[model samples]
Target: MAEVEIVVAHRERATLRVGEVFLKVDADRARADAEVEAMALAPVPTPRVLWRAPPVLALAALPGTALDSTASPAAWAAAGAAARALHDAPPPPWPGPSPEEIAARLDRECAWFAADDVLPADLLTRNRRLADTALRPWTPVFTHGDLQASHVFADGDAITGVLDWSEAAPGDALSDLATLTLGREERLADVLAGYDADVDTGLIHAWWSLRCLLVVRWLVEHGFDPRPEIAVLEARR
Candidate 1:
């Protein structure tokens, strides 16, 4: 019998790994459906969809280890390359969250952080100033929306797969790039090299701060550590 390992679990969703298969159970069927659809439409390599029935979606595990902070520059560049392909493809069908919606979220979270003393109001304030740069309008592209390093897999210089398409949507291309090189801003050059595009480094920095600020609260609420995000914010200082 394949031992079931809980990859991640929370109130909204849970992922379980049983040997070679990953079972994602999402409370929101629409997100799961969107994930399936996004994977199908993506030009780059995504996990093989074994089966899908409502909340339960089974996927075949990709080869190689998940990309991490310690991954080499070449691996990071490969991730950037994969992201470039995805971003260059036709945008997904969903409208996703509006810019106004994201801005509201950031404002609401900042207010909460100030009143509640969640992480550090001062840190949040400084980062918020920088974060504003990313809130501007940009040409929409096929964005992964949550291209965390952990969601990408690579074997040496080649990326074997990219995972978690639940947040796939039509959005800013730099947002994906920013998420890819989150805390490791030093690797932005390597990623841009593989991306083979001229990206504004300052704007990417803004997205980094913004993304960290927005997610820190959610991560704490979801029983996950926000230190990595906080560290990114701290790096800015």
Candidate 2:
């Protein structure tokens, strides 16, 4: 029998690994379509599409370990290089959520947190101070909308491949930088050096706070603890 592993399983989607092939079952077909298209457009290496059907995408796995906060600075630099390549590539046909939309969502989420007493009002208010920095306008590039550390794959100092492109679209490049470097400030310099662009540290920090704040409620609802992200936000103050 082939080795089968459940990579992820949740209400929105599930990914199963059978031997070297990965089967991603998504609740939304549009997301699946975006993944397929993004993979084709990405300048960096990505999982090969074995096939695709509505709600499921089959891909050949690439060899590497998942990128994480604990990885060495060299690895983070490599990830940055890969990201630079992705951003340098032409934008996808579809655009990501606009700043206005994201800001509105943030407003709603903050309200929800306050209304539900999810956290001390002061903490939320403190983080919201830098929130506007993140919502500022920026040039849109090809971005991996959900560029989590876990989504990047690396071998030693080289980036082997990136996974999970369902949210890939034309969006802010700093958002990706902020996502990868979240809670790992030590790697920020190396990553920025490899990115080969002028990046605003303040905005990156702002995005970091904004990203964590926006996801906390969703993470809680998904049965995942938001403590780690919360800690990062708290540390910013």
> What TM-score does each of the candidates earn?
0.96, 0.96
User: How close to the true structure is residue 152 of candidate 1, measured as C-alpha lDDT?
Assistant: 91
**Cα deviation of 160, candidate 1, in Å:** 0.9
lDDT of 1 by residue, 110-168 (tens): 88778887656677788899988888978889999899888999988899999999999
Model 2 poorest 10 in a row by lDDT = 64-73
Q: Evaluate all candidate structures by whole-model CA lDDT and list the values in order.
A: 0.89, 0.88
lDDT score at residue 153, model 2, on the 0-100 scale = 89
C-alpha lDDT (0 to 100) for residue 30 of candidate 1 = 83
RMSD of each: 1.3, 1.3
Residue pairs with clashing backbones, model 1: none
